[model samples]
Target: MNSMQNYLADTVKSIPPSGIRRFFDLVTQTKGVISLGVGEPDFVTPWHIREACFYALEKGYTMYTSNSGLLELREEIANYMKKKIGVEYSPQREILITIGVSEAVDLALRALLNPGDEVLVPEPSFVSYAPGTVLAYGKAVSVPTYFEDEYRLKPEVLEKYITPRSKILILAYPNNPTGGIMEKEDLEKLRDLIIKNDLIVISDEIYAELTYNGGHVSIASLPGMRDRTIVLNGFSKAYAMTGWRIGYACGHPDIIAAMTKIHQYTIMCAPIMSQMAAIEALRHGESEMRRMVDDYNNRRKIILSGFKEIGLDCFEPKGAFYAFPSIKISGMSSEEFCEKLLMEEKVAVVPGNAFGANGEGHIRCCYAASIKNIEIAIERMGNFLARHRKG
Candidate 1:
């Protein structure tokens, strides 16, 4: 035991396993558990994109691509970002293809952080931000965003967390777990704050395409922010290409160069076939992406209404596929409520506390499931709540 402890690096050993994956794994062990725990898109990759990959493979395009990925795909990504989000990045120096948003995020942290550097993170949000910062030998300072604020990070709250050592601000919108997004006005607040603090920003926009009603805005598109922000985006959520493991980051040439150095040594390049498919997704997959988003919007309506019918206080999620609702009425901690709900009703939702301490007394339900499944889960939840309240 002593020998094993000595061999393991304390940095790696000190980090805890992902809390979201813990409950997700538990659901897999149980029979007939209706899982709304994972933030995965239920839709499969668009057929044309898959077909393109197959064509690439049959044509013997299996060799490794340039470490920065195929030039053609990066061009398409730049064009897509320009037309869609109003941001322009150089395909040559500012864009680097990655294994996925996960790898892009890790690369961003690794490329930027120095020992004891502070990264300001907004929560309850994605589970990976803080851990990635810690692994890079930086401190993650959580800036709490509340349900009352629609989970949007405010300048006031953010100002309190900034310090002399602060080096980065990690922002993800159309945020995961909470589905909260920062509107243009909301971003203006932080934009001023970022310039004032002179902080680099790691903006994760993986769920940008899943936004409903309102469109997703890129912080990189804001005035004077392009050079200082590393924008991480992927085809997973929007194009239903999660299994393909493809994503990319766009930033200033120096930062992109730094990230690519790590990517080249570690990943070599994203799979050649996946890169081919992503090009198709970027050029011709807009309609398919819209169709999936529309379906999700319908399902979102059903889930939000069902929660209301069950007497839960659910904040209307404007973007992403999650619905975060308070379970305070059940008089149980989020973990207890989720476990009992799964054990009794066979429905699996994530305990909100898994996201952060501010997420306590709540639970996250992914609405990416089929409408029938969502309806059934909500019905079972109603019964579970009724029973628990009576006791």
Candidate 2:
């Protein structure tokens, strides 16, 4: 048998690979490419947080903790949520510490879905949810979000896509790529639909600290919804600790228990040192997060204003570092825009179509990049738009 088409699980073969990684690979191959493609924070992990990991190692905390994770880290995660998000979860039963938000998403989806069940996924979201849904033997029902509504999820939008087979709703806010956020009022609009239809929500709030307009509101915090929402957040975005790979999922005891089983078998636990560092990060990383948020906000303004100046209609991103600007003037598809930008300007931005079909006609730029690069990209974008001026 040819190794070129050796045996592979259908689940692995069925899923499309991440578009972000594709662009990342392309950017890596070409020299002098300044990437605005990556969604990760450019900041280094805080010194104290880094120090905690070293201390943990020194103390020989290299061994695994409990199967779920360290009690201390889970307790800290509980306290962090209670203090900041106005929600409380018991560290023992309600939370399962995970490798990262990525792992939490994977495990949560796998735990909740059965064959042919459907999950309603909001589009222009992070790349993982839809594929993960399919991998769980479920259908991913993508609901197109509108820039006109600021990408908010209204109940009518839900109603149109709802069917008897629908089981879970994967919601990401302070969303990746598009940066859409749903305030309390916006979330309340979906409360009845979610309740009446009995849909479970996997709320991914990885960028909770970066909200510019108002406080981040969890749908789980809304009335009667806490029991059904599996809230996922982590130390990665807030503490600039993506490499640490520590995240937690808090939800119904049944779901948490199911996830813990998967964790026990496949991963055992998150790294011991990372768990130690995660506790300290929750306790002390707030000020560092604030500074990062303020800097990102400044960069956000520069990019959004530049988009307007270049005549692209961009939804005002409320939370995450990405700005998804509509590429109306370039007379090009999102992929075309991105490829041309990288080749001609040596500046790399992710194509919107990579996120979903709903992302066509747009491109996502991460304001987490340096101000100098942001300015240069903006200047180059202006020149790029000028070449294909519609009027």
Candidate 3:
């Protein structure tokens, strides 16, 4: 087996396993752990959406959808995008359904990058962006966004990272780990820079519907960006449909065609039943989705208050269901803090560095868990911190 390892592709060997999953494996081994690690919604997929899938199955709609996905779903996505972001997309030519935003990310990178092209990824981001760049034969460049800026990517900072080799910029706001969001004005600042550099953007708006402060904004809606930006979104976060494995990408027809070529060969189409469920979600699921978002907002307030009471400085997260609080006060690295808290208090949270180096001094506490579990976890964490506080 040691000799066989030599035959592995260098690209595959170069990438490390997801740090988030590695630590969560330890959580699985521990009993009675209150987990605040995974970013998935705690709510069940709304009953109406599930019923739609069941009805589709009863009607014998289990066959493969077109490689671009069910036309109905794509049309619904088009309407949703137009209403949500004021952007128009041709469902036939510009939208391709994918196996989750995960697959959409991979497909976009694989279709867009050439060997040695640089992908500028704003850090403390979702864990997959860097590795996805590597897998696509691109160089992943980290563009650090400070907590002081509420983790929004700044135009001046982004300009410093651009070089002749930078080809793509990934925008994942309502971001993972940090729960940061980019408002319309923040994105407006980057518009000229993006156009000046001739770089394309992969805007992952998977959490678009979860924003609490105001409406979610897509760069694609900005002037001159519609043609250069690929928008990725899905039913996972908002609809609590993570297991459904359905997402879609909207971009220029040329880019969409390229992505579809790769997706057709690799994934074919998202599950047909899931596609059926998604159509119902877009048409009639907004009320339940809003109710869930309202619930998350309440949980968000409680967790932020809990961290403040514990003497951890946590920024207010305006979107997404996470609270990132600095753990430096405990005088332990993020890993040390998380591991000790889990072992001593049976509360599981992810170390920040798992997302990127900029995350080293903080810890990501997902508010997606129940309010009861979140409260208990916070109390446990406070106890653990008091015992472990350095003089």
Candidate 4:
């Protein structure tokens, strides 16, 4: 058995299990725990969207879609991109439906990376970016973003990380963990650096619809960035279709073709019913999605206020359904703070460092739960803080 362990890939062996999943597993074992840990939406997929999937099932639409996905779904995605981001794509050639945004990210990394190529990933962002880069045999270099900068990746900060071998940059706006967003002007600031460096951008815009402070901007929408940016989005967050696992990637035809080659061999296509439901989501699910966003915005306000009242410093999250509050008053590392809170208060949240090193001394509290749970969790967290706070 010990010798057989050597057969495992070194890259796979190096990566640790997801920190988020580790806490989630612990929560499942504990009783009476109110979880604010996972990044999933609390709302169910709207009835109409579910109905569409049911209709597809009744119509016997169960089979592998074209490796690129159903043309109709691709067309809907094209229309969605044009309307939302002011960018147009050839659905037939530039879009490849993926299992989820997770799969899209993986595909983009695998298709674009050469061994030892560097991928510049902004920290306090998603947990998967760095590991995914590693799995693709690429180097993951962290570019730390701070709360003082509203967690936006600044041009100067980014430029310092670029090297001759830095082939890709992963941008996740309406970001996870910290809930930071990069507005149009912010993206424009990075445009020149990206162009000069000749880097391909994998823009993960899964939370675009959840932006509250202003409209979400795609780096791809900026002049000269279209062909070089691979846009990944899906029905998971906005449409509350997490279990459905439908996502798509849009980029230059050559890149899309390359990604599709891997995707066909590996994933083949997203579920046919999910594709049908996503079409309904793009066409008529807007009102429901907006309703959910409005509710999350309300929760966002409550959670921020709750943190303030508890004397924790939390940055204003303009997008997404999470509030990242500093737990430094307790003088504990993020993991210690979260574990103690979960054990004592029975309130669960992910440690900030799970996202990256910059996330240390903070905790990611998802506000996607019901108002009552949010209120209760806040009170419990207050109790936990009072006991652990250092002078």
Local accuracy of candidate 2 as per-residue lDDT tens digits, 145-233: 88988898878887999999999998899988888899889899999999999999999999998899988988999889999999999
**lDDT tens string, model 4, 1-391?**
5487788899999988898999999999999999999999999999999999999999999998999999999999999999999999999999999999999999999999999999999999888999999999999999999999999999999989999999999999999988999999999999999999999999999999999987999999999999999999999999999999999999999999999999989988888999999999999999999999999999999999999999999999988888899999999999999899999999999999999898999999999999999999999999988888899
- The digit string of per-residue lDDT tens for model 3 on 1-391 reads 4488788999899988887897789899999999999888999999999999999999999899899999999999999999999999999999999999999999999999999999999999999999999999999999999999999999999999999999999999999989999999999999999999999999999999989988999999999999999999999999999999999999999999999999889988888999999999999999999999999999999999999998899989989899899999889999999888889999989999999999999999999999999999999999998898778
Q: Least lDDT summed over 10 consecutive residues: which range in candidate 4?
A: 1-10
TM-score of each: 0.98, 0.97, 0.99, 0.99
Off by over 4 Å in 4: 2-4
Give the poorly placed runs of model 2, Cα more than 4 Å off.
1-3
**Tens-place lDDT digits, model 1, residues 1-391:** 4467778888889888888898998899999999999988888898999999999989999898899999999999999889878999999999999999999999999999999999998899789888899999999998999988999999999999999999999999998889899999999888999999999999999999888877888989899898999999999998988899999999999999999999988889999999999999998999999999999999999999999999999999999899999999999999999999999999999999888788898899999999989999999999999899734
TM-score of 3: 0.99
- Greater lDDT among 2 and 4 belongs to 4
Each candidate's clash count: 0, 0, 0, 0
